[model samples]
Target chain A: MPIVQFTPFSSLVQPAFWHALTDLKIDVLRLSDEAIPVHGSYSAGRSVKDRESGAEIALGCNLSVGGESFSKEDKAPAHSVSATGVFKNYNTIEEFKAADKTALFAQVSDEIWKSITVDRSTAQLSRFLLITFADLKKYKYYYWFAFPAFAAKPAWEIQGDWKGASDEFSDTFLSAIESAQLASPRAFFLVRPKAGSDEPELAPVEEYDTFFANVNPVERTIAFLDPSAAPGNPGWPLRNLLTYLAALHPATSHRVLCWRDAERPAGAPFKSRFGVVSQGAGTGEAASTEKPAAVGWEKNVQGKLGPRVADLAPMMDPTRLADQAV
Target chain B: MHAIQQQYWAVRDYLSPVLKESKFKEHGRITPEEFVAAGDFLAYKFPVWSWEKGDASKARDYLPADKQYLVTRGVPCLRRATALAYTDADEDAERLLSFGDLSATGNEADEWVETHAGRAASTLDSAANAGNIDEIPDVDESSADDVADQVGRMHIQGGVGSLGEIPDMDEIPDMEEEGLEAGDDEATAAPKAAAPSSGVIEASEVEVAKGNLLQVRTYDVMITYDKYYQTPRIWLIGYDENRTPLMPAQIFQDVSADHAFKTVTIEAFPHSTSLQAASVHPCKHASVMKKVIERMNQGVLEEQRKAFGAGAVSPSTGKDKQKKWLFRRTSGPGKDAPALPAGEDDVEGMRVDFYLVVFLKFIASIVPTIEVDSTTAF
Candidate 1:
């Protein structure tokens, strides 16, 4: 319900793929700024047809997330949504609550964290349903991600023409979703600085890591996902939420995109990751293993974004983010 | 095997290993005894479909098999007579289709049950004008009776009431009109449930064989929808002990006796015996059933050809490896899947979907049975 300015991919090159997707009439998804309704009711063990068909409709309230003291008839503030605060364990609140209600969340009482708790402040408590925002009939897929809960908006002095970035990223992601035409899809992945600090404290200069798709989880040794960050893992976690859900039911499958080290294109002047665009070497010879620092090129950033060359190499580039080409 | 019970179990055992299941097939790898054990294990994991073999001597009449067995997707259901007794003879007269829903009271599945049960009224006539109704000839004797009798064996060419046809009716497309003008409209309105009403035959009420057996309420409905198929299709193995096909009863089992009196508005086209009898579901799974029937019809063709008793090969015998494989195994089940004709393989191969435990779970959910494997659902 709060208004905020946003930049799409913070002005990256991948927005091109989204531009092609506009022909499909798919909604561009820029959740960082777009308004999303997050109130749903509570209906348990309903009919399969009823549940599947009306899953998007707000459910009626059965009880409050606070203690069991709420009266049986108390169905106030029925709409519910999930928010990241103190209670989310293993990146999902379900693990924390399912473990044991009193044994867990009751210990939390920080003044600053409480001020930002969407569940308690808006719905009066965190409901297990996690207020789903879906249009299966229209979109055909769902993506889940975590957005930081801000106590106060950052000063506008540093903010760019946010609407441009918002529309660009929205169109790009929407294009990807429509292109895939995935059925009953549920996807969740983290976005973090590959060499810098954790996602919450990421700096614009830090490159976002595509670790899930790039690094194999089977490795005995792990790389620090964000070397300069204080809290994220140095290597793929021995465990994670996506892994848990997949293990819960191996019947379903997940599609992931990852990053890897690879050679530069045959004619490219710079040596870079297979797809990631980097400055050209002055000698035009085979590039080095390490990524060369930015040279403020006038051209669009383009190349593969994964372990190997991909079909979308042309559009994966984050254009105009490095420096003003002119 | 003198007693009916003894005769029935013997046939069940014979076909248990070799029964033509949509998902599971008992192949040569397993012995007949192992087939029975595997089948029994399946029954424990899920409700055993309603099954009982037909008359011993007549099994030979329907197919060349040494035995014949009748299986329902679940327990066979008899419709209440009140739903079918239509009181008038007008275009608006009710053409009630389907039996009542048998799901447990207050269960989540009940909502779906009610929706399916509401389809009792149909746009199809009391008799559909099936221009090409292929009648099945009742098997009169044993496999030893004579090879000529095999020519008359009947299998459904399509789903339900229109399962198979009576070869004598040459003008079947006009059969619906003829049935409409008949003096007694009850039989025409709901052939399956058309028996003269005696105020008897309610669901879960009849006690057959004096309650010694599990006749503990064999409840069933006529048709249900599937997400994969996207069509209203009923799943069942229909037939009776005398080798008599049960298409009519299954179709009209839910028609209230009074349906003959109420006027109706034709909303959908005609389906032979299923609630969705109006149209074939457009999905591949539904087409899979038709593909199966088409292959079975090839057996009919072979049977008709064999009727000449010349014992000579057809000049048109196919050279394809699948056809050759089928020719070798025609005597048993599984030969029905002939490789596609040369050009038809261009599409994705529609292999059988039921080899894994997943398909069994799917069928149970589709049939909407009383008990399902709880652990497998998640």
Candidate 2:
């Protein structure tokens, strides 16, 4: 899979960015049909299933802001933007039946537009890395897409290009070159109040009990709640919604580290551009070099160290796209 | 421990079965009346009624064969009379009767009244300590005559007035009759002679009106009324008009020895969380002094004596503080005998001698102990 470091447009009006994202050449992870894996510590294990189930069922994502972003902050820097996490189904079942995938692509695009337009949405794109194949048996698979903020319409149109704005670098390495909204997520859920006297108030959790309707605060993942598990038994619904919310307004983010490609931690067996040195003295050992041939500061330098860049190239092996990526 | 246990059992046998037949097992939500009544019962039953080192004395308990078991460690407290006895009169009698060999017992028998010297300083609940209980019987114990008749007899004996001039009034009312008249609206008043007008016509017998000197000084105002004789008993520690407390020596000297047996001095235990006084029993000398002056100003000492005549309404297991005996602001033979008057005071700061309330409660506790009154008491 070749990751193009794809940067989605700031405006959903950009036909170009969406065109490239919808392009079929490069393989991508289908988060819309997948599940995210989590490992954790505690659970109420009074039941046989509960006792057997090891590790708390934590539905998390690489895009989480360490669980803190789930809470709104009044003093967040203006440049610090959040992506709404939106999920979309990949239409795997249709593909199996040999169906045209344009409708599927269109659904994804529509959700992308919604994410850009919707305020405080749950359409984040970086949530894809949270998917875990091990969990496919539970909720099956799904995909996530992230869409950033855009200006209100009528008075202005999104330029589709964000310039002069400083990119937020919680990490300095791999920058978020682009982002996109997964418009119509197949699994996203919004907890709607049950009608009538026992009508639910519109909030994540009512009276502190996790209400499982179209939202699941516990699982931190959102999916259309099981229709059968309506007003009561909101556990599954709320958990899915919460997980999706967590993925979007992640409390922490997964950082891809791209080190300077130069520095290594100190104190090791010496490997020089010239020759390998064995059992080298700690630092002040360059003084013992029989070849008194070195530059300034060499008089004070210690071990034999080499500074040379290694050559690298992309391999031209031919592998199937599905096997390599999704 | 045995004395305390006995006190516990005495109350447990009564107030317990607090709500249901649960007793102490489940002292669930008690009505305020129960709270006041139970508070008093617990206080009296578990007084810090301890004695100093061998200054203590014991009474003969010839019941159980094992002498050790027969004799309890603590000194007798809250005796039926002024002088201490082996144990409470009823408890001692019950124990003695429980023996296989029925033994002889009397007020003078099982009792071991401290030698005059032993009780010399310890009789702190003397009249010198607090309220004027009955100093005079007003009438002889065996006399069945009402106050009017008693006065009539004295007049006839003196030959001062003629019988014809004495207007005939049937069913001569007792001394407490007017109080009852004042309480029950339907009860008609007996006719008084044309001479003895309605408005306090110089109550010929001024001594009856004196009603024995009353002084309720301390917060723990101990009021003990002789149930059998139906006379008020109080141990005062307040001042006379002279502002000087009854001198210690004057108490013993002024009272006759015979007067001692008829009076039982119900003492006060300091207020604890369980048992509290209406006015916190002031601890410091200055505070106690202030409380005394405050009590005098309220004329509670005067109020209590009047209430004594009004007769006790008895603390029912009711939440209304007004129903509790300790709830009087000013006392008289008011409705149902001072019932409404008792309601006038705020429960807080209103002086409540929990011990006194509990005592009356026990008098009416009459729940016939299982061992004692298995059937019924006549």
Q: Taking the candidates in order, what DockQ does each have?
A: 0.01, 0.00
Per-residue alpha-carbon lDDT of candidate 2 for residues A150-224, written as tens digits (9 for 90 to 100): 111111111222111112122111111111101111222322234433232222221123454334333221222
What are the runs in model 1 whose C-alpha is more than 4 Å off?
A: A1-103, A107-187, A190-326, B1-378
Residue range B1-378, candidate 2, lDDT tens digits: 323543554465345332222121121122223333433433332221111111012211211111111000111111112222212443423321121111111111211111221121223223333212223233245243443342233211212132121112221122111211112111111111122221121111111122222121111123222112111122222112111122222222222233321221212211111111111111121232234334432443444444454554333222222222233422222213333334334223333223333232222121111011100110
In candidate 2, position B29 carries an lDDT of: 24
Model 2, residue B153: distance off in Å is 9.6
Worst 10 residues of 1 chain B by lDDT: B258-267
TM-score result, candidate 1: 0.20
For model 2 the local lDDT of residue A98 reads 32
